[model samples]
Target: MAPRSRNASAPTKPLLKAPAQIGSLDAAALVGELRQLHEDAEDPDIERMPSDNELYGALLYAEKHAKALAMKQGTEAAQRSAAVKRVLLWEYLREQTDLHQAKAIEDARAVKAEWADLAPVLAVSTPNAAYNKAKRLQAARLIDTAHGDRRLRRTPEAVVEAERRIAAQALAERRAEEQARQRHQLVLPVAQRLLGHRDGLAFDTDAEDWLDEMAAVVDDCHTSTQQVSLARYLGATVRALARLERQTGKPPATTEAARLAYSAAVELLSR
Candidate 1:
């Protein structure tokens, strides 16, 4: 039998190899290597472009390697290096993707339009990468504004400041939450004491109103100033009621009950 013919349609071996030690390269060299790999992958004439999984693997490897290099440098230096890599990657995807130019531009515009929505999700992978990608996409969008007017692109400083603002906002939210939690803890016992006093007073008509007011005050205890106001008002009201009871003389069966309610209200105010 004749020898089997070679399969001319078979895929060729990859032109590039994974680096033995991607971590050995400095940030600049690693970025350059990535650009080269991306260019090779974007051969438009090929029926099938380079494997996306392989490209992603290479990117992940380079990122991890860059991070290792950054650990030895200061944090600021590492952040700058990561930013550079992310910007380069975004630029590569914009310019050298196998997609038609119009499709690529459309995709980029879509990303720009939804950047605010996309940022937090992207940040789950790498904060520096997400920030840099958002900045570059915004800059690209600014290049062509309405009426052929090109806006000034954001500076690196602006991007860094934006990131700082996001971080600061996150911190402020956390502090607010902690403060609210503390206020709730402080107000809960006072609210319970006030409810007990309502029970002891036994004013059928006023009990519902008092309970509603107490509920409103408890709801507003998220703020320290509001808590203080509620506490003072409740204390004053309780004291007035206690004075009235003393003047009128509580029934023997309810004298101790009135005293306990008055004592609780006093303690709630002191706290």
Candidate 2:
């Protein structure tokens, strides 16, 4: 045998392994390793790394997927929070409104009852303008009779002064009575407004903090621009009260101020 070929041995083929699991590894490192394995399996002949455009596409896909997942999770969380808050606030507002409304109604009823009870007494005491005039005429006649029958006659100066004083006092008393009647009438409308305000204020107390956000899905009341309407009204009421205080020489604790505040709160809450 001429020099037998030293060794013509067959080459053994290398076995390919599956991609790594890398579950415990950092995601960034794992992704890098996965890309290397992909390149090796696909084309080991390429010397340079993958193209920038390919890496950019991968990154964009990953970013988009991440953003989508985050958005989904965030939305789910927000919805849960809103649902819970709505339930809690609904109960709170209901209780608050009902309680305040009941109290207001009770108070109003009491005032009405008191007024009713006093009406006859007032009518009996003051009567009408015509009756009041008659009473004055009767009193003047009695005084004149007394003057004529007096044991001691009155001097001219004293009599004239007394007559003038009596006329002045009667006029003053009549004006005072009219003013009191007017004030009483004014109180009725004011009381009604106050009751309305109290109802509204109670409603607003529950959601004043989150009304704007809650208003989107909750539609108990209409809102301007789907935002918290009460906030503006509350502020406006405060300013209005302040102005009233300045103009009327009264403080914010006055019934009118309280009523305005109540109205503002109610308008906002209802909206």
Name the top lDDT candidate. Answer: 1
Cα lDDT computed for each candidate against the true fold: 0.49, 0.39
- How much is 7 displaced in model 1, in angstroms? 68
TM-scores for all predictions: 0.31, 0.21
lDDT of 1 by residue, 130-189 (tens): 545555444333322221333323443433444455578779988876765675576567
Positional deviation of 256 in candidate 1, in angstroms? 4.8
Q: 185-250, model 2: which lDDT tens digit per residue?
A: 433343334434443332233224333333332333233322223333334444454455567675
